[model samples]
Target: MMRKVFSIIIFVFMLSIISTAYAKKVNKEINVVISVDKNRVEIGNHIRLTVGVEGAFDTDIPELSVPESFSLMYGPSVSTQTTIINNVVKVFRGFMYGFSPSENGKFEIGPVTLKYKGKRYTSNSINIEVVERTPFESTIDEGTDRSGKRVDINKMVFVELVTDKAEAYIYEEIIQSFKLYFQKGLPIDDLDYVAASTKSFLAEKLGDERRYEEVRDGILYNVIELRTALFPLVSGKIEIPPAKFKCNIIIRQQRNRGSMFEEFMGGGGRRYPVERSTEPVKLLIKQLPEVDKPEDFAGAVGKYTMDVLAKPAKVKIGDPITLSINIRGEGNIQTIGEPLLAPDGMNNFKDYDYETKVTITDRGDGIRGEKLFHKVIEPQSEDVDFIPGISFSYFDPDIETYKTLTHEPVPIEIEHSDIETPIRLSLESAGLAKGKVKILTKDILPLMTDLYSFKNQGVAIYKRPVLLSIIFLIPILIVVACVYVQRQRALLSNDVGYARKKHAMAHAQKHLSNARGLLQLDNPPEFYATLAGTILKHIADKLNVTSASVTSDNIYDILEKRGVSNEVIKGLRQCLESCDYGRFSSGQLSREQMESTLETAEKVIVQLEKQL
Candidate 1:
């Protein structure tokens, strides 16, 4: 009995030693391990930091804290999980912290400490790199990204605006992607943009949020890419406005290096503003050539095949038939309009129209998708026997011209029914027939003319041969003028350079109008560059030359051979010289001087047009 009592005292003493503040060794040991999804992250992205406290203890769960650089968003969401294996019990207390780094460069998030049962334990430090952008992205940051809220220099995320093509023909399919690239794990409060208006290009999202890891400049960054496709509405230079986004990101305020406990236990991280944007992009969209445009081409672009289906091939008069017209292709399926179901030029079918329901499925390589149209139509008259095949025309971007596809007519056999369907005839609200009725009327002959009441005013000068010849000649002249117009249209439609020459003046004028808005620049470089571009483009279009080949030396030769006045040639030289000089010089120039330069460009083009 004395030995049993002595064993109990020893057991109690051991327990007391294990719980001491300066215990040499802890039998109920908990080794905290720090882990993250990634070692590198962006400011807007988040990382999951788990402080895993693993031990064979029955109790004594440790508390954890991260470094000062990371904004701990959620948790220390504590989970004290226990499991048994091989008759041995294990306990794991995971303290997970969702944090976003607010600073850039390398940060050591460690020596996180946990305190339990009067003892303190420290975890191994984790090294992480936080950057404004991916290592692969070298795009410089702009001031436009700053919002009203404070920004952490270490934590920066931004959006990227990219277009697949620098130039596109009118109605050509072009992809515009807006990617909100942030660090992985960063929580986005709300991300949104105003829906693009119908007056510009059509915009469609390519896919949902995509997450991946990319290494840029040797730094690994977690990324989320959002994609969109833009189809320009009109020709000329269309500006896709910059995408705007508003967000809130946690900021790990500056604090001491020792314990993470002070921040979480005292006053934790604050939420800061993270607003950023990509610069607006300008797309040079040229007009589709009218010369080779098919008369049937309805401005559809891409490669496509068409077919029409009707539920019931045969129907009685007034019975409805469900028709499905499908167009499947690679390219802008959304731009395809309704098919002309009555292409046989027969009035047999009524105008049945509907919106094209497009299913844009992006096959791993590119957009190979389909569009469907469903409509219900009834036979207007018993005489109509078959639904004529319809024609759909689209410009094949691959072939650089319009191609028409025809869906073969659907045959419908009519069944003649002797049933006399009652038709109701109603008068105005004041006089209406209650029951169905038919009205019958007989034709009446015209009354005799009263010739005695009319008197001749004159001999009728219009009856003379000369006046009659002039009057009769007018319509013939009009017919000839129409023929000439048709021929001109045909030529313009067929020749690309000829079309460019025709609209070159108008195009140059449009560019000048844009430069007019730029005249407010306090500097001279942009104004001169724009002014020079307008003149060069005009000359290229007029002379059927590429802009790159339209140097002043070559331009002089062209103008001189075309017999432009030396004075006009000199003015052209002066304009080019002024642009080059203003582009380089930091010299002060008045707004009036820039306006004068603009005038010189316009006047030079007008004179050259008349001369050459």
Candidate 2:
């Protein structure tokens, strides 16, 4: 017993020693460091900063303590990584911020301090320099200069971001857009990946980019536009970042010493770069009023009118009714969420879908447009005859006041529907007599109820004079079919525009039908290609331009001259782009998406014909 007690005492002493050693080895101090991506940047360029903390799990991000002269465009793009080896785990947490210089100068950013688990840490200060925006190498041609250097396409080709309004209230709708101007043709697919980052604002992308001609400073430029409906998330001065475009812009390749020999060897072409960017823009967003705000306003910041409608005005009591709520006007139509309806409105309906179909359209007047919302409901109350008036409230940034738009009540006519219960046929009464001379045989088949259609039975077919005369019309029909084919072939061979215009509808339909089958087979790439070609080819033929020259750059001007409705023109442009995106998007899309894209393309083509 004494020996056992001595063993226990020694074990307890060793455990105490191990505990003290572990406590001494665990480092409690966290290391915090601040690093900047670049010390100097153009006025619109983003200066990135990373705040890193070591050995931290439950620690707050250290304050960046940026100087007053810088504008924080976006912040705290958070990232965390962890690694463990030999039972020792290491964790690194980082926060990234993008800042734009408000004025050209040198600035110092902080000795920021942070605390974690009763321990304090500090980061060293950082210095940043800002300079005025510089133009990129602007002009490049297929020729070399006397200095043996290629000319840069500096001012000749550049990008600019434009907006209609200079100032807005917080959460107010603003139209922000980017435009690329070029003197020569470019491969736009390279820039297709370029997208507007709405880091500083809540945004809804306006459908399809618009392309048009703008003669700026006596230079006719091919312009491509990308637009967004932006609402400031916070009240402050916001600097909208430039859209980084990466495309193989045709630049002049410098001719080396072997240029003449290489050209003779069939290597003659221009060199292209991989990326380009537009200048950033700034907008002043003032704080919205805290007082005199309406209760019904559901974050709407535009001038709009509301229209309420019920499908199938006359309906049986048990039938489902589709309710359409449409809002049209200027401002952020898509940003307007669920409309604020009175409690009594649609109280008679008990069944409703949990989802709503919301669609937005841009009416040629910049971002001013239309929004549609759909909801399905079934009537449950017998006494209610109509849906009550619904109201939508919005703060008009232009008027600087709150305005409420009300839609009139939609009347619903409900008729009593008789309850239906299917009655099963009784074996004894449904002509299957139990003992009526019936034979059960393995080889015999059951008789069909109507082996022959009685409606045409016993009609005199051979005696009719019209039947005898039908054969005489056959030869004439064959001759007419042959003549029509010959005429069509001749026209198709001679007049390209007429031939294309005539068969555009048929070709589009055939492509869509083919895509339906492809969708079932899960073929995305080929499906997108065929669909895009259908639209592009159709438009090219309609404009009498070769498919190679029928590009987005010159489409708007041509359509406008051809007297197409602006609305239809916009829809066509959006649909064409939708096809391109469907073909080129890297992510796998669902059957529904593929189907929707096909439908949009068809609608655009049909509408184009109508508008023409």
Candidate 3:
């Protein structure tokens, strides 16, 4: 019994000794986390700081009470990490906070406290020295040449000017789009913008506010393009002034390391100051030549052709006729003048109403759009009259001559009415019958005939014959419903994805049509561009890939993965490559060659649809 008691006493003593050793080791270890960022720091400056804790404890930290000398921006980012190296586990825990000096001085951070395992652990007070910052060089132009133009340069306002052709006749269009990119990385209280003057140009602003991602040089910027259509006031050089603005940005920095885990999780780095923009930019413009300019030119340039379409070559009176004029050839489609209609007494047409729709290319072309005008007219007389022809005049830069389009006038034939009376009556013939009959007069009927006239009373209310029309509109609606239901049933019956592929087949055909149209119009560049864009957009939509990600290899990989036939896939790849070559090299494909491409795309779509 005494030996057992002695053994127990020795065991207790050994455990006590191990506990003391562990406590000593824990007291000696420390975990540190550092952070740096801006909060109430000086303008165009960043504030930095670090947070640390030294104790033998697993602690839940209370929030730090900051002083008036510094302003705390963000913090109390608590973290914990346990690392086992060589079986020796090191557990770290604490919170980090960032603050900036309100005024230039030495500011004390904290005697931050934490409680772990029923014990209080206090951090050593940290001192951050803040000093007045001297002016530094600008990132873009600091100590650069000031002799040229001293334009206010910064992030917000900038100008980009481009011309369709550097050399052209007067009235040729030169496009200049001014874009402004702005960002408030720091906390901003408020913001306002002011636009400067645009001189010596007819500026028509286009589009509402829009934001998009843009990369210039190597910097990624969120850009908003504010566009304006500019027509040169005179045939000479013109300079555009820069726009300007002022904005606020916050600055902060990490001071000290507090929790190592917080350091690792917070990107394992410190925060820094951010600066806002207070600058502007300028643009230089040059004008086209006035020499050898055509008289019919009204500022239309590049290459173009006018197409006119009118409905119902044969129609009766009181029928509404629709005229669709499409002026489709590249050059500046947006800036083209509205087609005019001449005055005629035959068809009493009202004033024309106008509307425009725009489609811009992925490449940096001038503009693409369709201008529409709607006109309503009524016939003034029953005589056969003609609707006057419209005149569309523009200068052909390639031909260097004025061209005028005089559309053929529409003729109307008014036929005499077939429903007419066979018998005729006269007052003298009625008198001969009256002499044979008894003539009677009422004495009560007084001679009040002066107050009323029976001369116009015998005329009929409606002299013209009315034709009956019983249109079976319900049957037409039923037919439409049948078509829609049949289409839906067909689509649903097939694999939905396969049906989608079949639809994509139409898009490929459309690309071929665009190519044919361009070739027939004698425009090789636009022919290839339209063909390439149509095919690329179609493929991208099919594979659910972004336009930027649709490279040739990626397309092939996607197609092969989808189990497309190797033969069809090869032909598709070849078509895309051909489009690319034609686009870049401006290679002209013959009509037969273009038709063959259409046939190839059709075959490929068919084969792929079957496989799918």
Candidate 4:
């Protein structure tokens, strides 16, 4: 037993030494590479440029000396990758950018340069050719598949941006959709979408992504679609920018030599990245007509009807009466303001600020929902007999006219309050006869007459050493507590990172509780989304970075660098991927699966708390 134990100790020591040597070697090596998704693109199209650094986690962003003809669209989406094989760990960081060319010409992008640990590394330069936009019909080409089947390459993959109307009134609901078409049997993954710019409109996601199969141009294809409801904010000629999408197409090839298991798995495949962009769309927005517009119109544009109700028809004066005004039937429900109450009719009531709640539902066609307003009003006097009528006005885009809906006054009965006021009186009002004061037998009791009572029964508390020590410690404890509170306040005010880290766990717990509540509702998508957000937000707070920029791709290296265990890291990755699947996939998850996911997430977070 002693010899076996000695061997185990020696083995552990040797393993540690080897790990340290490997870490040192990794720290000494650094590599930088820069590449673009495409070397040629049309003038209106954009290219993705990526700068990758290996063997290092912290490095300055590479700067590209862009030419005057090229414009930067969006950039520097950071992604981190970490891989461990045979106990060897490798770290990589990537920075990506989208660049659009203004004119047709050949341009050189870089010999990108990066600075790391006081050393400079350079990458090879890339040449890009920008050509004029080609007509859609002329862009199609014929190609052959692996089985020699004739295929239209352009028709194999494409994207389209469609709107229900090319022209609309201001604040009108317009359904805009983005559809991606790919050949039915082609394997596609890693879809990165950049939505069209909607700076001049109010946009809301309609619903979950729509997936189905369709036949286009006599070829069967699978389609993935996303929908948004947009309301134009201003009236004028507006040009909606083109939407961009990038995805990878997997191409399978047979391997020369491999194990039977590998062969059964179909060996491996290469990914071919493809990008597509839709043509720009122009829309003409007409201003709302000013003819016969309602005087109380609050810029509401939609079809709506109002219902006003007052509860508790019988009440005493000065008692609160709740007025529920519900406006239902669609179109920018969130932007709708509170309905106007007749001022003259409200003279007898004491009105307070009203609260509003909006409920919106996307029926896969357009935005339809209701806004409810709850106003509390108290009758000032018994003379008030009825609540005033409420009115709401909106432009009917279908009829091209302004319409007002009014509710009839709701009658109520008010009675005098039952409680009576107390009467106030002064000393003179009492009318009491004045008389000379007679002294009582004695104002104070005589001092303790018994000598035994005066004898000290116990030592005085102030005189005893133990008691005095306890009494003196009170102020010391108070001072210490005050100092601690002041230091905490100062830190919370001045140190952002410390404050975020301090509240990170509490915030995560709160969100987790909310997710738990969602679990009882049968809404798997929302529950998983909330759970995933909680984890990402917790890590973001710990690292003092924005939650929007934290993704599964980069989280591995981040946690690994922070010394998180491999088991916990893998569990976290699984949780996030499961959440992504639950959120976007059309299939439903079983209750047991959801419960297990939630448990796994909780465990991962608890483990992270110990290390992070």
On lDDT, the leading prediction is 4
Model 3 scores a TM of 0.34
> What lDDT does the true structure give each of the candidates?
0.68, 0.69, 0.52, 0.79
Residue 590 of model 1, lDDT score: 84
Candidate with the greatest TM-score versus the true structure: 4
TM-score of every model? 0.40, 0.39, 0.34, 0.50
Question: Residues 142-194, candidate 4, lDDT per residue (tens digit)?
Answer: 22233221222465589999899999999999989999998755666556789
Off-target runs (Cα >4 Å) in candidate 2 are 1-150, 185-193, 249-267, 272-275, 309-325, 344-355, 363-389, 407-612
What TM-score does candidate 1 get on C-alpha atoms? 0.40
Candidate 1 lDDT over 1-612, as tens digits, reads 999999999999988975572332323466777777567677766777777777733344444545577787787677666543333446777767788778788887777777766677787777778887453333223222232223333334666777888888877777766666555444333344442333587655565446676544332356656565666778898887777766655344454333343232222344456667678878898887787676677778778899788879788877778888899987777668777765553565565567568887783334668999988877767787677777888887656777889876777877786766444333332124334344221111123256577767876766688988988999999999999999889878687578888888899889988778778644467678888888877877887754534654356787788788999999998998788778756587788888899899889988876775
- The digit string of per-residue lDDT tens for model 2 on 1-612 reads 999999999999999997775444334447887766456556755666778787765578786688777888788888776543344556788888888777888788877788777777888777777777654354343555433323335434578778879898987777777787765333332244365578878776665568786655333467877777787888888888777765545442445444542332222345466566767778889976767887886777777888887788777776788778888877666567676556776667764643554444553544666677777777776666876677788888877998888777778888876665433244455344444434333224344456665566565777777976787788989999999999999998687568778877787788778777777777777677677777776776566554544555456777898898888888877766666666556688888988888888788888776654
Residue 285, model 1, lDDT: 88
Candidate 3 residue runs with Cα over 4 Å from true position: 1-135, 138-173, 179-191, 206-224, 255-312, 315-367, 374-391, 396-612
Query: Which 10-residue window of candidate 2 scores lowest in summed lDDT?
Result: 260-269
Q: For each candidate, how many residue pairs have backbone atoms clashing (under 3 Å)?
A: 17, 7, 30, 0
- Positional deviation of 303 in candidate 1, in angstroms? 3.8
Decreasing lDDT order of the candidates: 4, 2, 1, 3
Q: Global lDDT for candidate 3?
A: 0.52
